[model samples]
Target: MRLRLLVALMGVGAALLCAMPAASYAQSCEMKLGAMGPMSGGAAQWGLAMKSAAELAAAEVNAQGGVKIDGKQCKVVVVPYDSKYTADGAAAGSNALAAEDIHLIIGPVGSPEATGIKPVAARNGQLAWNAAYAKNSLEPKFPLMFHIAPGPAVWADAVIKRAEKEFPMKSVALIAPNDQGGTDIVSVDAEAYKANGIKTSEEYYQRGTTDFAPIVTRILASNPDVVDTASSPPGDAGVIIKQLRLAGFKGPIGRLGGPGTAEILRVAGGLDVVKNFYWFETVPTEDPKVQEIDSLYKKLLGKDPVGGTAVWADLPAARMTLKAVSLAGTDNAKAVAAELRKMPVDDPNIGKGYWTGKKQFGIAQELSFPFGIGIIKDGKNLGVERQPARPD
Candidate 1:
């Protein structure tokens, strides 16, 4: 009987041991988030900034004990890939990301690159937060692909409406690339200008058509009071601005998207040309919430911020995503995406006195955060001037 009791105790011990959970060697860190962009090519500046922003967000999240997903504390780790500013590369990277177990993916910086990844994002059950200006086709077709930037039409409408009040300009000349983003800006300009009784003089140029003298001569002949450049891709806009300056056309120029205006200011030899140029994208130092962000960014990056690029929005976007994921209690993509859709207009993360409208299918509510018309004055990047009357 004593031996039988001992054997019974041993069996119980074995059962207990078997029932206990095994020690997992797998890291309990947050599920990885993928970021794809041009980190190696001409657009490296934007891509590096994006990577920096994502890293900053990840650091902040990890410091706070990470985002909780499915009852586990999962640290957010950025898995960044450089697509080299090519469509085929972007598509392949996006496909690879779709195959990964990650729930969310952030970025393909350029609109063209973003375009390449859209289809893969739509079909693969992965959520993509694209850092590019809005395109119309993504909405009805690619519902899962979210844009973190304002739509081209909305941005253009705001610029034209504000221009009427700030500057007396009836005749406008538009110079844009032969791309979808540029074309969308032109389409929006046509409608907005028509509404405001302003005439639009159009100029369409290929991406690298460096010789803008002939075009500048014709644009000046039209005697435009304002020139709207929808050129992105950085280099193209820089060339256009230099040629325009050389042709002595000093009217107000509007940069619809990307780092064109800022790059022009850097290469134009002085801040003289920048003062006359207006950039419609969000700048890093514009809002108070960003002051803390800027402080941190400067601490890490050791440099000032640049405007007209989505890198400015990247960190904030990541923060928003992480916050929503934490609140939702899971890294489930659909759940997180739903929470993001309900983001409040008066979100504290945006800054003081800022408000956003209802979240759209294409963009996060934060992109609607007020934009500044940045200029380069005396060779220094200056913030907005002639600030619009804040909406009540």
Candidate 2:
């Protein structure tokens, strides 16, 4: 009886030992990162792209044994929130994510969301990167807020010059949503066009307006040489383009706003419909290194990334944020911000960039990368031309 009891006790001890590692692994360190944007609606592409970039970054870090936090390798888990491209939506999303103890956010992709998330994120001790072109995207008071890329103020003049050479225009009418997101970018674009000695007119419509026929009629009445969709969501821009064409306005169409050419093409009924188009491409996507981002995303995430060039533009921010988190040795937002500010603006895929925005935003937290100008002349895709980054 004593020998049998000893054997049973030994077996119990072995079972406990065998179960220990699995339990510990299950309870291992995990860092939750927040990714916010409009995951639905017309702006879904941009938001989804931000989420995809964050996931790819997290995957890349996890593959290398995860991020070292407090001496333990912590696996990153991305918690996404669809901000719905509104101010209140972003503010609420920040609070919701803060409740989950997530201190870093990948995006709130529009100007209104940027405006809304800033104060809430600051109060929550969160560091959020906003890809908004708002006039005040990064204020000195909100040091934790970071800009994903330089706004139109940085590249609009260059793009305008390139577009002017291709499609000479005397007067241009700019149309956008009647919100800060639209007004801010359109105002800057207007200035750029005016500076180029071109006459400019501004048109605004309420957000969520599907039919732009009335607005198109009003715009065509001016008989402008060009119509610039300055920062309208791609879906809205496509509809506007279609209506303008139907209204018998055959002038060149320019998009001096966000990068959404692919979506615009799909929504506007392809290249044939959007003939004589000129727009901005956030990166020199034609480069072999830049083009490699898609393959890398596929290899890391086991899926094709959406959002076209926007994903490539957003990836560096996510990658650098992870690097900062690892270096800071904590998920603390303030600590991560300090490390991020100190790190150089370098990405293997995007090449070198600058930490601009000191002059524009009163903070040097904006990433300025080499951009490109895409053209579709006479219904043929002319490809994107790479332009070097300008110094602040």
247-301 per-residue lDDT for model 1 (tens digits): 8877777665554454565555547654566566554346666456656656644
Question: 180, model 1: CA deviation in Å?
Answer: 0.9
* lDDT of every model, 2 decimals: 0.64, 0.91
| Total backbone collisions for each predicted model | 3, 0
- How do the predictions measure up, each by TM-score? 0.77, 0.93
Q: Could you tell me the TM-score of candidate 1? A: 0.77
Off by over 4 Å in 2: 1-27
Q: lDDT winner among the candidates?
A: 2
Candidate 1 stretches greater than 4 Å from native: 1-27, 40-45, 84-87, 137-141, 164-167, 208-214, 258-261, 298-309, 345-349, 352-367, 375-382, 385-392
lDDT string for model 2 (198-295, tens) is 99999999888899988898998899999999899888898899889888999999999998998888888889888999999889989999999899
Write down the lDDT that model 2 would get.
0.91
Of the candidates shown, which would achieve the greatest TM-score relative to the real structure?
2
